[model samples]
Target chain A: MNAGQKSARRIAASNGPIPRDTVCFSCLHRLTHPSRRPASTAAALAESPPIPSHQQRHTNPPVTTAKAPRKAYQLLASPVLSRPPLLTRDLTSFEKAYYLYQKRLNERLALPFTRYFYYKKGTPGDAEWKRKIKVRKTPARDIGVYAAYGDEGWNDEVLVGDRTAERESVVEALVRDAEGKAIIDEEVVGDENKDGLAVAGDSKTGEGQRRDLTKVEVERPVGRVTEADTANDMRSLSRKMDRTLYLLVKNREGRWRFPQDRVYGRENLHQAAERILVQGFGIDMNTWIVGNHPIGHHQMNYTSGGAPAPRLAKITPNRLVSTSRDRAEYEQEEYGEKVFFMKGRMMTGQADIGKNEYGDSEFRWLVKEEVEEAVTGGYWKSVKDMLAER
Target chain B: MALLQEVTSTFLRRFKAPPASLHRKWASHCRHASTGAVAQETDELEQSSFLQGEGPAQQAIERFDPAGVAKRRNRRLPPSRYQFRSPRYYRGPLHPHQPPRPSEPSSREFAPGPFSLPRLEQTYHDTLASDYMVLAYAHLPPGQTAFKKGERLRRWEGDSPYFKNRPLRGPRGGDTLRLLRKPVTFRNVPQLQRVTVHTMSSDAINSGAALHVSGMVLQAITNVRAEAHEVKKSVAGFGVRAGMYLSLTCELKGEDMYHFLSKLVDVVMPKMKDWPGVKGSSGDFSGNIALGLKAEEVALFPEMEVNYDMCVRYYLSPTFRIWLLANS
Candidate 1:
């Protein structure tokens, strides 16, 4: 037996005449030792120097000790008064409150987050047919910010005008003279022709004027080829490995896609996907989810500079961008990059085309058949599993 | 003259009163007529004491045998020679599980290959079309009949006189009636299609750690990271803003949805203290189901269970919205 139990036995044996109080060892220890007495007689103990341990006895009936020790002894002697082995206690009010608050927060966050998988929906219109035909002499590559365009009210004429402007820019870039002056004065002539087309297209729709204005000032880079354009083409060379479903954007490249951005070094696939949707498509992150899990992961090989490399885009704390001239030194080279495709649905609003800073002409929420028709080969095969009919 | 007048009055009074006692006696006699046969049979049976403790009179009770006195042979016809037989039992020389005989390679083309693929032309199904899109329960009208299945509902209105005149020769032909006769089973009954998870911060609006923890917790539960859901409008009461990262959310559908439900109901819910399950009254009366979960209760999920000690301090109760098709 430990010291406390030994002391208990000694006390019990010495006080044989009276019924021994089979009190708890800790309580008995307190009684036998004068220094560790409870504060019930603290005042009396303080007034006089504490009774020495050797002189202390259970029979010594001091006035201050009499009432307190008897009560304590009675409580200790009770069979039901045994202490638990672990000596744990129930949570305090403050801790309980904190737990409750935390619980409430989890419940609020655990509200089932919904993600929607939308395909490019609608019958191919005349303008859409024209956009599908490659206007640029160069192939349309997978680079640049392409995202789901949700707004449907925008007119096709504006999109057409935007396209023509983009074509003109490309033509100008391709046909530049040695002095960098345009050999073609076709822009002015093209403008006049487009204006005529706009008037005719406008007579068919009410929003003709807005369409005309947006064609000139649309933020999405239409025909301009960036580093991403070349990189995307190189990366997407092998159709066997990489699979991607493209969104059909009217007046822009027909192949817009579910928004995806480059993953920052620290961020994971889902975080990057959410970031892409929010920044590129103007989706409300809190209201929607990319998906409960990634539908698929696609890897593509590419060559940057001269060596075979994976495409890497510069990631700012808030947004992802293609490498710029100023930040070239700091640009981190990422190779063999993997893209995770997830299903996303809007909880509050339809596709917010207004927030789509990248210029996509119009959005069509496609069905499974339409999605299959819009995308080809490996991408369609992967996407077919995740298709949501509703 | 007085005697003659009194006699005439008495005669008039007698004609007017017309046999009151006689009418009552006739009514009592009719009542007895209605019950006479049944009452006689019961009275006879009771007097005989047939149903009382066994006596000599109890043997008078008769019994009927539904199948007659003797049992008849119960048998079925033997199988026909043309009936299909299982290959395992009769067709194969060896057991069905036994491998095919190994042979030396004749040619690489003739040899069994490890992989197989369909031809390009044969890659797709021809029946897939947009026209087949049928919305299930897009809306629900109230009432008992509205929610019940197997009812013959007028899904379409054939106003044409031609259709009305030739019901058997309509678009569906004779099968139309048969199709209508098929009772709507539970499979055909509309169920929840997907569940949406909406996560919001219960802590300070701008606490980075709280948002991070919320996102991580959601990720662990779903096996996919939670996407940030920005507050669309600023609320003074909650100190939220239009573009602030308010919470994270994700949608679970098909396998993910059912799997999560199984975990929530089977694994997590039983561990919670004093937790009553989703109330029947909690339904919107259409078809959608919504339930709230406390953070502590959510922690019981296998995903979050292991992390209790290093628990994310901030918590937010989340609502799970199960979307189902409403009765159209």
Candidate 2:
């Protein structure tokens, strides 16, 4: 055999196989020489595949079974097994309030839970879903505003305004010590902790900040609501939704529109809008976005009061037992009530059909095409305008 | 003096209540008085001796027969008496075809006769009595009539498709009733094809330690050392690039597989919270059932669980894919 053939055979014998490719020559040379290789490699190369002597050295020492503790398998099977210990303690009132407040705040500020998605049933631009938003006026107390602040206007404590300057101010006030000096830094007061409870915002502020009700001499302009006062910020749906708007429909009656509610005395328009949403369509204000401002408004001539009424009436008018059946309970009065259409983004709650003014109103989330087909007359024109803007 | 005394007594009776002795006599008269019925019955029995002698002179004794005694030992319970109220027998027919047969009085014309004998061929208005077959049919109730069976038997007289190529066996050696056919042989092979642990992380591309630790975790959990694989293509947006060790995978077979599976099913899986047992539908149609565990859950293995706190954050939960090969 030639010298090259002999070396190839020798290399194969030492290191299994050597590929006749680039850069393998050096590895072959290293395998042939024991002195050039590392001690670990040399030791590994000393043993063959099936039963490696080097692996034997690495094996764990034989365990002395004589006095070893009984294994899990060897233990006597008992009827009752120990349970995992409880990891929590009953919450104190302060902790409970803190968590509850945090939950509400999170729910209010968190992104809408549901995404706007619909199947393209027909051609694009065909109205699918239609809904009407009802607007009226009611008393502030009915909308959960208990104690009114003396024309500061409404007490931030009593008012369920989506946002107020006093909300941050109250938190700023609580961060101060008994001497009324700022204990925490200004930044900390503004910053929400991991729990998002606004560590500075205390439950005491909701009660302690209540001021006595007093009439103000100065004329306070009403209906001045901004985006901050309500969570009207348009949130993009998570999925790639088709360019379609779904109108909320009341029942199977093709009369599709956003459910509307009345504005109560002492209640801001946004609060009234949410109240209407809750009562009319069973949409919880917490889980949905009721715009601070009305998207559209229409005037209807009916026996109604334009200005906020002293007391709020039920959304569903109750027929008085004393009144005659022939006489309409809700007869037109002297004045026309201006109805505002507030746009709302549905988040996480289901509409309670049982709570609807009209018995058994089935709310359908219909697409743009279906909405156009379902709604007609003045409603159709208004909806068309709304869709045009989109 | 007598007139004065009578007037005084009369005046006293008129003015005051009656005397106590008179009231006692009146109370005794109002009370129910008992009659001496016992004495009268004894006197009557003594007078009428014939009336007492009407019944048997002595009590009847139970007779013991030898045959009856022997038969009692071998007495087998009647099948009907054992479950006499069985629903199978007592329950009315679900959908009876005909109304119940009405009873008819026996007549002379319908009496039994030798109608089957050809010598006694006689035409009569009572067809059932004249013909034996008709009589037999009449004897049976409507429900028990074998008209359908007789028709089915007669149908085989012509050239039958079932007996076209084969000779028909007589009533003796016909088709015998037997149990169902043999059970089907299943070709499903449950051998472990391969065991792989896959991990994906943006951090691994930058820090080699992440890849090493992942491989270590996979090896520690499975007891089979894993090989680290790198992403061949660069995806800049996700920070994934070529030659970046993105995953660690291991394959197990034979004993290693058995040990891993036992630990997974017996120990690891049961410890998981909110785990509704794996549904039968949770597979890719193939035999392989892909099971995923959270990082904290995968740390339940002895090796990882021991030093869990130390490398808790570093441990990325890799999906342990167990492929089960089946013989097609």
Candidate 3:
């Protein structure tokens, strides 16, 4: 071959079709070498590091027969961390409270736990969501506060006014230092912590700092509330809600409404509970979801699949309890001066009626008894705690 | 109103919680009173089955077979017997909160989306506690170091969306590179299509949320080598995007990404605030959300495991995403 074309090829004696003496197309031998060139280009490849082709270095490690610790070796030995050795020393109530308080404070700064909780009643407004990065609130609950419960001025339960941290700590301290006999203020009504003995209340503080209770203000669950408490309890309902209803069930009080069409297809809780009051709530407790619609004032909606069928019909006013917290207001809002008639229509394809979650037939009060029975025998607030056993 | 409704709904879920008191009472009584296992041993010596027995304790165990056994495995449980005496007449968070129709929550039917939630702080975390989801909505500044999973952040009662602790697979490889054991999937993909027809009062609503997915990293470099014995570089920041391989299936009529996303703020929350995942360190959760959908909705769409690999990148991660699910 001519010198010009000769540079493109190579010959390998051991490797057949290729000659032993040849340089790569880009080699200096190809560009500027003696025409005859060296017999082999073996020196070139030997000195260079070969780049790996397509295979990835480590998509996964080689599956080794030798095992890893698997879990913490100690964890493998015991699985669970042994509880902190229970103290050998008996702790007084105050000591226990102090321990719990210190533990909680340490926990407060500990990580992440702080990011949760608080601001539970409503979703932050658009501007608020943008401006308030700390935490958020629930929309439905907030709407209720605005539309109906506005400024009853709660200082205790919610974090609306501030001094909340001090309040929390002070409460913690009280739990640490206060004696069981400390009579609670009437203001210290609800048990802040589940322990039935402890009551957390807000003392009026215009300056916004936690203040100690006036000694004999502790509230306790008396020997046992009347059959009302029992009645309320047996049904998974509570009487605390009466106060809220006392405030909302009115033409003047605000309303919490649901989308009108949503009344169907979804569950109506009030009627279901009424069914249970007449029948009885079964094992699988029924629950309800609430939301707001602009239709009107605070309105209640109930839904549940786990409800029992109603046993009675044509409930009358005489059969109803008038002094109920809920009844007095619901009657006024529902009937008004003009008087709205009891309306009824099927919930489309809903099957077996009488109070299952998807069951149809929302009540249109035909008589005063039905309305009153609904209010007095209706579901109570305490019922929300079926899980509070500990 | 929507926010309050959601919290109320969440609060309401506790209404359905298993009667801890009842469970505890029944468990303690049944467990203590049960000499049955011992009695059964005695009966075997006499005549199996033919002897037949009677006792309230034995009967109680029989009455609460599955449940009692379940509580037994994890002791110190809530009462499993009798629910609150009678809730037939209860209403509102016991009264006024009720509405004509309870909202059909997507959360009720589906499990909360799993996550690599980190509890950077120890005080807020316990190795064994389980809680229902806690959802907290916050308006963060344009920049405030995206909160890490395990970092301590202040919160209020009933404020967080973190629900419970779910053991998950951690990351593998070295500390620098990690991976979840299984492809962490999102069952709640927001369906934007149908969201519009829900007839939006749509008002001017701005919302943000914090959802906590509790799981351990499938394979993680818990202890990495810095030198020989090695000093671990304190975990700085971590983040997981919505998908390392997120796939979408919102082709159906009304459900699309946006529609579902809108609803996400109110539902699907964390059980606790800023909880850390197995790593026990909150990784900054921030990311571009990629919607995940069920395969039945469309054959053409891919799955979350393979599609959403990008979700867990190291250090710099996007913010927490709100996943709205149509059929989660």
Candidate 4:
């Protein structure tokens, strides 16, 4: 057995009779031994001065000893749950111009349209298509360098006006006109009904008109900017359409940080993170922890009597022996706390933090840059690399 | 530029040739013309004169109706006259005409599509990939020595004369060398390489029906053709004879692999009666994971469910072994 375990056994033997309700000597031995502690505690011990083999007996205490070992640092699991971008990032003006130029070049180089393949001969639809093509007035297919300088080429001279301006296609314009007319007809019908007049002929004529075969019906795409974006609503998940949004909450101390909770008894970091989400935001938001491991970590030392404790430096064996007289004072120092941040993805739903639950706390969905500004300098330095650039 | 120069030079030469030589070339071209001799003559005449009057050709073009032509002629049109047929076998690079690569549409072994991008693939590209890189990262302080690993192959240490020039021994406990895992970066994130679905049925040795059924079921579910493998050596305990076709395997890649995985995870696995999950210890140390499916579980697939009666008639109960390999 190691020196710590042997010392614990010797102490227990000298103490003689133990209470029945209390923990057995073996359990106490396991808890008191530094070698038997968890990996995190073992790592902490590795950085501290090693106790001389002869001093091992005095370092540990028996059951009758009033003072217990220094309390382990409190661990907190902070989960940074985020929503991925809904839309692709906006294109720059240069990109827009380049794409348009490439598109026009593609059209010029493409094969000549074979009208017979798409439309039958002598039909009204074909006639309409022919008229539309005539209006477009595309140049005929030609060979050699002359084609590059032709009127249809993607040249600065040909496109002297605003090059990147979005021009409505023929089909889009036709669709828009049809929708406008329908809306106007509806308004007219509503007015006639209010006046108690029967305009049957006009309604019949409007309904009798057939949809244009050559004109395609295109649905206008939804706008990228939402109400949340316009109002600058930091609480809304839909505010940023093209950037990753992280959920940050204000703690009782009024510090802005990621949603976090203390690591409870016998629970791992990821499990504590899962519990933190449900307790802080209720059982509504659907968030998934990416993995069991922590993505980043931050450590803070507690202040003692209004002054920060001296930072611990690596102590050599010779130096440790020389200062053995002050070992008691060194052992009593508190190491403060460590927070392990776990990465997660918020698939759906929002954080519903009840006022009574969190005690006047608030939550905001912030992007990378805003998060950096919201948290402290040290906190941002620790987590800046973990956040996605976009 | 050289190709363009060659083309222009050849064209100028052909254009400036003597009348006698031009006539000779035309005669040779007509000789090579197969069934379109008349059409070729018409095309030459059209090229000779760019301007023409309002003739019968213009009237015929105006009157042309494809639907009427198709209705009047009730038979299917003849096969395309000059359609290229890719070479069946690859001769060599030195051959006059080599076969096209399998990626080309005309190649004999070409397999098309990736017709649609799978949702899982899109999610991987957007999120999982970067997260994985960050999770696998390990930071080291400046001026620190890198971690050194012990030598894998053992060296001879004895002073014997025979040991002086001997080769290093294989790793302890096993002859196989384990794959080295490099630090994950943006370019080297782990990704699914391919999936292999394998099944061996001893019943196939006794009857060919079992083999046929297994092949059909595998192809139906995986969207890839299954290849039958014959037993090289007989195993008495397994009750198989040499040279008997006893196994079928289907390898899926790209779109097919994603579709199969998504379907299995989203639909089939959840429908199973009592499956917990693929065990945590299912993967080989080298990054390939295997999962087995019972006969009933195999039947849970949507493709098999559609033709459940047909599969039941043949008693399709071969256990499926699926292996998912990842590129690290």
Candidate 5:
């Protein structure tokens, strides 16, 4: 037979249980509506009946012709749809939520994340030193900054694209571009390392506030960050393996949402922080503040010149000790000789993302830098000073 | 990217394909025909049932019975069967357990080889369409009757026995069942696997969309007469009925609920064409898929409820595996 006929025969031969015509007949016989209502369709399928499927064989042979069904009569004499060992299956709520996400989220469009184990250095008080990380700060650091994107109820009161969250306004989350190099630069405004940075929330909450919020955490080297030392020298660093840059999107409900992979990493990181404070010189002489820190936070940040910085991008400090103990120990071991470790007063901070800055639509904060000279010129005393300027 | 593995094309490639143990070699065979034992049993049953079904044919054949049922069969029959039962039911000296005993070689060119397929225990089916497609559902109008299998499809002058004067065909069962165009060869070694059955309705089937069914039962029926026999083993001697299949499947799934009936009407029944001799299309079913895993994790169920008057009907679809890959 020619290939077409050969294939047709093969198909027909391979088709088990029923003759090809019967299947064709069953298809049309079961058709509640003609696939396409060609004027000739009714004429074509006139002999067919609608074959309903479900449960058990409700009615076998929905239609019978004088020709009779000589095909699978043996099938007709068989058992009803029920077979033995009935199916049992179950799913949980979170699993159901994951399934819901899986259903609606297109795999192709799905961006994912991965995490590795390692500890970070410093206490929540470290944010003050994290920005001054010896690691060369670049324009990229400014990209994720949103000055107004602080913890003060910004998330609840305003939504995405709010006038305040708009790029054009003073309330907008903005970062100084290369052209405006002097905006956040220590050389232009004048300030001490890590000293000017403060949590953006109620003053009381700001105490360890930066440790409570959800933010992108890029591990960097912490040359020697002690809970006593603020983040005066933390630098956001990236490793070749650390290619993931979490971009939290907003769900329809206007809540910041990340994929499960990202969430897993964030949660793990939170549980991996240490509450002990490093004893040493900080913002001023005798401040001697105790602060929460990821023990190995120092290694998480580094200098662009490849040198290890003293801190990294501020992450929510984990108060629960066991989860963050490895990190705490790693940092303590790495810099234990240089700094003294001590427990501090609620070294934790209130850094959760809130609607205080922008209305509750989806939004990401972009940190900007003042002109490189902003700090060296001694123009700003604290992050409040910087916020007040704009 | 290259394929993780490949199977060469050749005859002995599957069996003697090496590294495979002698036991496996012996176990993995498709017999040419059911053994004389199975044949004897099935034939006796088939004869009794056939005789009980239609009397005239049996009377005509009885006159020639002097040679006996087995001996007089093949020799006296016409060379080909145009409007008669298949001779496949005959035992012809082969074991049903082995997929196929090597067929006796023939001199004819391109002679079809043995029926070397595995035991028809469990099978999967899928559509062969290559383009992106969807399932749709529709219902018959208020006054018009549902389209009949052999009757011509009637036009709705926007009128009908349907409440909406519309004719609605259910979801993608035809396409789902279409996958059975070729029965797949799976292990007959008795392993667990999930068989997904999708249920969809008329409007959904017509809309050209994949139906989504969740938290509902799914079932499927392929044209397997041997499967019927397998089901009959339970009652041992009682006559097999279409209804028995459901309970058998439900029992296998470990569910005591009348899933077969629910699954049949809720899922499989709506998509099935009427089988001959069966009366009502909507009744308790005794069958459902013996799923190996939670369908939600592996497959999706079609969910679409049409509300027209206060009444609502659900739609389910068939679980299809062999889809026409778009890239192909």
Candidate 6:
């Protein structure tokens, strides 16, 4: 072989390959000697470190056990379905007082009312409005001058405005005039019948009808507290308006935990969780699983002293194990159970455990605090971090 | 005039008259009247007929009826001339009359929406955020320090004179530094920030029709106005010339981004023919993921389907590139 061909072969052996055009001795020298190379080329050569033995093993086939492996643990997919709070949390007394103070300050600094623009002159409605304003006796404009300087206008107490007085809603206020006249007419008729004085009652009715024009019957707002809250109904989803409620079911073993079902056949965890929801609670509810992945997992190890009582046999009867002999064999073979909890959300509908195909089971919709109290200490420790404080 | 007098007399009677002595005492203590020129002016003030209760100005206001005015003129009254118009361009901060921010109602760029919170957003807040935190948590026993990865940039090894004060070298393999995966917490939960819809049409260089169609389709799908981008460099192979508008891009944020994603995932993607789902290997190491859609797949969107004939020209079709960015 020629010198050029010999040098090219040597370069190829060291650096994988070289271009056909770069087969000259000078090119071979540049490729082989690091001192003669550019800074970038030298740096690139130094960058790659030798791969560790652990990583190198990835290229080889995986090792298989010579002996048969121990029986796998039973896998369960538990869906922790919850309902988010419907209403904002109740305001504290301090928050209420601070908001009221800010409102009063805003009113004091507001521009003077433009009465002429809103109320036309010589109109009965306008006259009635003016009369109502006269009774209020609020300053035309305070501009905080009185509050700041302690003038005669300052009362040395919380500034009381017309808003402090119980005011009817706009709808009630608008219909008040018509309703007031009817009420006065009824009262006048009653007075005339009782006293046998029609002539005197006729004059009194005219005055009363004019005076009661602004009177309105206001309906009180519905209270935030629901019947479920007062009754302490743990089964009702609507019990807590301002808290996230989780669904915890009591298994046949009388243990409180999230509704879970064993993985059947080749079904995945997500599909298993969905099946558990449908089996534990009837299909009347609308629910959605957040994702395919499990949020958390808890492993319960079975003691080697044989199967610790079969909880599944009591719940699923013949469906899971078929016969007593099969049940005993299945229980003894399984090492333990691993429960993977998937997050889910309930939009509507309540749990109908009684109508569920998975036999009779008691269920409760509980807040975070109540859930901690209802569950066992070990189960609580495993799940407490996942539950929302609110 | 008679009606006005009668209204004033009724008002006076309805308001109880204060005691004469008390009224005088209160008037004498009035702060404004106690001032310099105002005190002298009060003594000369005369009760003119025009200044009486329900004056001529008040009467004019009572007679001012917008409906009647419009009827007399035989046309609707013009909109109020005092309505504010936001400036189209914002001057520098030192300008006397500065333009309001884009978030302000008066700003020209103010686009208000998010009329209702999205279901996906609600789900993220209610469950997903906390679930992510729980799943990503790594327990460290008390007094134990976290194991950190080795420095990405190489430090000079040899004590050469030139290397004494020199900066560290760039990252080993390449100059690009990867984003660190910080432990997930309540404050640093991953969240979708915005979505960018982009389309490039080589056919646009020959005819503007391709560019226009792409822009319109992107706007319809994203609910945002598409901006045309000029080619920065000329390429002979692609038949694109520098300064030619051959691509369209639209950015969606907040409500628009969520709505677009939901529509794409729930409606369009499932209906796509022979779809293999987004490739698992499609994301940048950072939090951004990009997916490409053929012209046929873009046409499957409900918006384009509704007006199929208007935008379904196969020759003018443009492939779409969608980028989803998440802030970690």
Question: Candidate 1 lDDT, tens digit per residue, B1-328?
Answer: 9999999998899778555688787886554321212323234343455546454343342333222222342653365642333333234556554333333122212222111111111111111111111222122223212323333333345787655644343344343433232233324443446666666775637677777776766766765557787778888887777888867776765545556666777787788799777788875555567777766777788867645434443445343333333221
For every model in order, the TM-score on chain A comes to 0.29, 0.29, 0.14, 0.62, 0.14, 0.59
lDDT of 3 by residue, B1-328 (tens): 9999999999999889675778787776554321212323243254555446542465564565443355467554465452222233437575753433222211112221111112211111221111111111122434333333331222333534552343332333333322212211222221122221110110111111101110011101011111111112322242223221211111212213232332332222232234332232323232122332222221111211222222232111122212322221
Provide interface RMSD per model, one decimal. Answer: 38.8, 53.8, 29.7, 19.2, 38.5, 22.5
Better of 4 and 6 by DockQ: 4
Candidate 3 wrong stretches, greater than 4 Å: A1-337, A341-390, B1-314, B318-328
Superposition error at B33 for model 4 (Å): 57
Task: Supply candidate 3's per-residue lDDT for A172.
Answer: 37
Candidate 3, DockQ score (0 to 1): 0.01
Clashes of 2: 36
Candidate DockQ values, in order, are 0.01, 0.00, 0.01, 0.05, 0.01, 0.02
User: Candidate 2 vs candidate 6: which has greater TM-score?
Assistant: 6
Model 5 chain A weakest 10-residue run by lDDT:
A74-83
After TM-score superposition, the amount by which residue B191's alpha carbon in candidate 5 deviates from its true location, in angstroms, is: 16
Per-model TM against the reference:
0.22, 0.20, 0.15, 0.47, 0.16, 0.44
Which 10-residue window of candidate 4 chain B scores lowest in summed lDDT?
A: B32-41
Looking at candidate 1 chain B, the ten consecutive residues that score lowest on lDDT are B121-130
User: Which candidate, 4 or 5, would have the higher lDDT against the true structure?
Assistant: 4
Q: Candidate 1, which segments miss by more than 4 Å at Cα?
A: A1-390, B1-187, B313-328
- Model 4: per-residue Cα lDDT over B1-328, one tens digit each: 9999999999899778486776788786664322212323244454433435434575676666554555678776565653567777778889877888776655676644434446667656767787787677665545433455668888988988988879998888899877788877778898889999999876786788888888878987997889989889988987877888889999999878989998898889999997889999899766689999998999999978856766667867577999999888
By descending lDDT, how would the candidates be arranged? 4, 6, 1, 2, 5, 3
Q: What share of the true interface contacts does candidate 1 keep?
A: 0.00
lDDT of 1 by residue, A149-175 (tens): 212111112211122223344344344
Error of 2 at A242 (Å): 63
In terms of DockQ, the best-performing candidate is 4
- In order of listing, the candidates' clash counts read 47, 36, 178, 0, 262, 0
